[model samples]
Target chain A: SQQGEEDPQALSIQEGENATMNCSYKTSINNLQWYRQNSGRGLVHLILIRSNEREKHSGRLRVTLDTSKKSSSLLITASRAADTASYFCARSPSGNTPLVFGKGTRLSVIA
Target chain B: DVKVTQSSRYLVKRTGEKVFLECVQDMDHENMFWYRQDPGLGLRLIYFSYDVKMKEKGDIPEGYSVSREKKERFSLILESASTNQTSMYLCASSLLGGTNEKLFFGSGTQLSVL
Candidate 1:
């Protein structure tokens, strides 16, 4: 069971700044997903980038996957104060199995 | 919209007591999972069920058991609650088939064992 490991345990930035979080996994994957959790709340799915895809965008969120490196990066552009949350990356392995999540990076967006 | 719901948002139980955490999904998802989130441990899978009366142990299945008697409902039972088991419990559901599908998570249950 391989799990995605996100870098930078915690990050803080001002409003309107861009925030980037990276994730790395050990094995082959079908897809990678990014989720955001507000304080004391369940995680909400943000975006998913397939293994073959290089980059994807949804609103202010952008995800890039590099299968060669087994790494993925999630970029939230023009971060808002409301964007303060814990962002996690999960990887779907090659088979029909559960997605494995990382410890996540706590992002604090200051106004 | 797909929704996964946990029966309780918070629970408090004494050590040695039996604890039951229930979850239900509105969508007829074929897969259901139970995960515990801790401060530094991230989200560790406790158990997963792909069908009724079917279950699979996950990374940290110790002291945890699951029942999936119904298609939409799954239960995580703590035979004997322990202090170390106090953590946020999350239930998630996903459609069957490709592994690339997204998972829908519940609001979560914060269980406190005294």
Candidate 2:
């Protein structure tokens, strides 16, 4: 039940354009994390945003958390063909629980 | 970098066969998890262990079991493999009880149940 929904199940963008994905949860969370998975590969941790923090940035990635709306968004700046991958948002509901992930947003960066 | 290694990158087994997927972490993480990823369904946690000999059921743990007899090793066992059980299995480890800690995942094993 702690699982969230990722908006825009799939997206297509140009190589130099930006891409954004959203995740909305049904319950309060301690922290939210974004992960990227290449085709047929395991996920790579991108960034983590705590409930108290409104925004966090790491290199080309920016993550924003809106606790009031129980939603979070991940934005990738200047996407590349290599950036074509599925992105998932995971939430740690409580200290004792493991992270629950969303279905993921599949992004296609055309070169 | 933390290394969580799943024993096999790909596995094939017949229905009703006993299967064991092994995972080892070199980072001395206190928590380990087993998850199966499926299309449209995302990643579903099957089991997790916080300590040696300690196991907890996740969202979908019916057909899978796990063991953590050693601090660095975690294993997922399938009593009898089924066709529906065919999926990519991911192993991950993280620090002890910290919401801020990030999970490091293995390359994953794609299991094919015939």
Candidate 3:
């Protein structure tokens, strides 16, 4: 079974607008990371928020984690056409186990 | 800068042919992983190595095998390629045993099994 499931599987937005994607997980996690993938390419690390941290920011990207709800949300502000890509949320379990990822939210930012 | 490289950017092979996908990381990370990405399926971990010559099976390791001869390289092998195996294969490496360690990914190899 998939540990994390992202909502709004596909989203379309105009450039310069803000896009928010949500992710819900089933188990407790030590940390959660977000990654971005361009078409036909590998994933690029975005940001990571640990269970102890409630929110984090990097550039135009903001990430929030609520351990009580086992959920997280990523907000990309002032989205650009270059931001059009698939974003994935991956969870790392409490130990040395590998990270598990959600299907992802495909965001399209039209110019 | 950390760098991870795959053996090929694209490959085509016939059914029943043995295939090998190689991954090398220049960052000296101890953990290496192999994942297959498909449309709507995200990324599925096929195999992972925590150290040289040590391997573990992941969720979708049914028809795949892995070899980690050294710390910097991990190889994924398909015993016999099948048409269904066509997909983008990605390799990643991370530091050993850090809760917040981030994965460094390769550009990926788009394998087409005919």
Candidate 2 CAPRI classification by DockQ: medium
Q: List, residue by residue over A18-43, the lDDT tens digit for candidate 1.
A: 99999999999889999999998898
lDDT of each: 0.93, 0.93, 0.93
Q: Candidate 1, A7: how far from true, in Å?
A: 1.2
Query: Candidate 1, which CAPRI tier?
Result: medium
Estimate how well candidate 3 is docked, as a DockQ score.
0.69
Error of 1 at A13 (Å): 0.3
Q: In candidate 2 chain B, where is summed lDDT lowest over 10 consecutive residues?
A: B94-103
lDDT of 3 by residue, A1-111 (tens): 465889899999999999999999988899999999998899999999998999999999999999999999999999999999999999998877899999999999999
lDDT of 3 by residue, B19-93 (tens): 999999999998999999998888999999888999999989988999999999999999999999999999999
Candidate 2, residues B1-114, lDDT tens digits: the string is 679999999999999999999999999899999999999999999998888899999999998888899999999999999999999999999987643578899999999999
lDDT of 2 by residue, A75-110 (tens): 999999999999999998866788999999999999
Query: After best superposition, candidate 2 residue A36: deviation in angstroms?
Result: 0.6
Best by DockQ: 1
| 1 against 2, candidate with superior DockQ | 1
Q: Residue B63's C-alpha lDDT in candidate 1?
A: 98
